[model samples]
Target: MERTLHLRLTCGLLASAARLTPVPFLDDFLGDRARRLMVDKTLSAHGRRFPSKQVAPLYADPHGCLYGCLLSAVKLLLFPVKKVLTWLFALRYLTRDLSDAVLLGRALDGWLEAGRLADATDPPARLQEASLLRSAFDNAVAGTDMQLLQGLLMKALRGVSGLPKAAWHAVRRLRRGGAGADPTEGLSQADDDAMKRGTAKLGAALETPEARAFLEAFDARLAENVRILEARHASG
Candidate 1:
């Protein structure tokens, strides 16, 4: 029964996706439609498998799925806008005449440390330097502390101890017509590359036993949540 329901939901989503036409800023319509169809079909299938008196839970599942799908889709659509805003703010901050390189350095250090904790890996010292450089670029965009910002950024590039040679190479490449000589331009390009690499790494890592176990646990929780909703509907 679950297999049949899953297949039906998948087909519904695909059909919705196929029906959408591509357009700038409106591409999410297709994904949104697909997500809605998936949720609706899943609930409908559940309703058919159970009697009308027992269909309340299935309806609740669809409701929850609909909200989750919409939130996810909206977030995905807004990600590009957020990146652009980040770049704009960073550029504005870099062209100023403020003097707080030391403070900026501390902030960058803390941010890098937090990133390391999140990733559970000891990234090279160069990563922290990269973080500071990136921060300086952001500060310039935000139009704050231009002199101090540049000083902090240069310090990050040169004085930051243990910076990876590869990072310096990448920075040099950016400076040498890799992209716009603008700091934001180089930062954006590097970010894109990093995202691509991170995604690839995550895909590979998900194949490990630990990742598989985590996925299994997550799936179990999802199923339990659905069942609980179903029970509430039944009781109502």
Candidate 2:
């Protein structure tokens, strides 16, 4: 019965994604732009600095951006279907593809590393990349899969190595907190503390309304996703 429900949910998500009829040409254009932005800015510069080691990282950014663009386009196309389906499908695709997660992380890392933080001595070239990463994270957290949501959050943090040591410690603490608990049990005190610390660090560094909004949205979404997953398991 559990397996059957999983299959049904998965199929429902896939069907929704398949039925989406995005403006292919526009999506293609935006994807190309995102790719060009990554390559011309971060990847190309990084490649010059570390020619041999840069390919994988550079490729990941554009790949993730393209995937994100595709997902966004699909959401735009299927907007009339019900917002929940759009959120679920977008989350599923973002979490399912390892490459996509890597790319998304790299993109975020690049932005953070480029000194896009509010506390940076100097502002970076553009804020678009950081915005994209936040969007991806938000979408993933709002989905139905608790494990995937946590995994994606970890991946995103791993990519942002430039985040303060405090942030990294917070992530580790959160991981440890969630270690023994069933995914459906919700976040432990450690997890809550980790989130609070990370959010504080972020808020201090990037004192922007948008940034705070994203953090709040993420917290809400994560809690909601966990509740949904737990309810599903309980029902089974």
TM-score of each: 0.25, 0.23
Which clashing pairs does model 2 show? none
Residue-wise lDDT of candidate 2 within 99-198, one digit each (tens)? 2323333443444455443232222312332334444454554453445333434344343333333322332332344222212124455643443443
For model 2, the local distance difference test gives 0.37
**Model 1 agreement with the true structure over 1-236: per-residue lDDT tens digits:** 33332232222222222222233323333333333333333334333231222222211223345675767767667667754553455433221211122222223233333442123333443333333334343443344323433443334233323222223333333234321122213444554354234333334444456545544443344335435544664698
On a 0 to 100 scale, what is the lDDT of residue 231 in model 1? 67
Number of the top-ranking candidate, with lDDT as the measure = 2
TM-score of 2: 0.23
Task: Say which candidate scores most in TM-score.
Answer: 1
Give candidate 1 misplaced runs (Cα > 4 Å): 1-25, 33-203
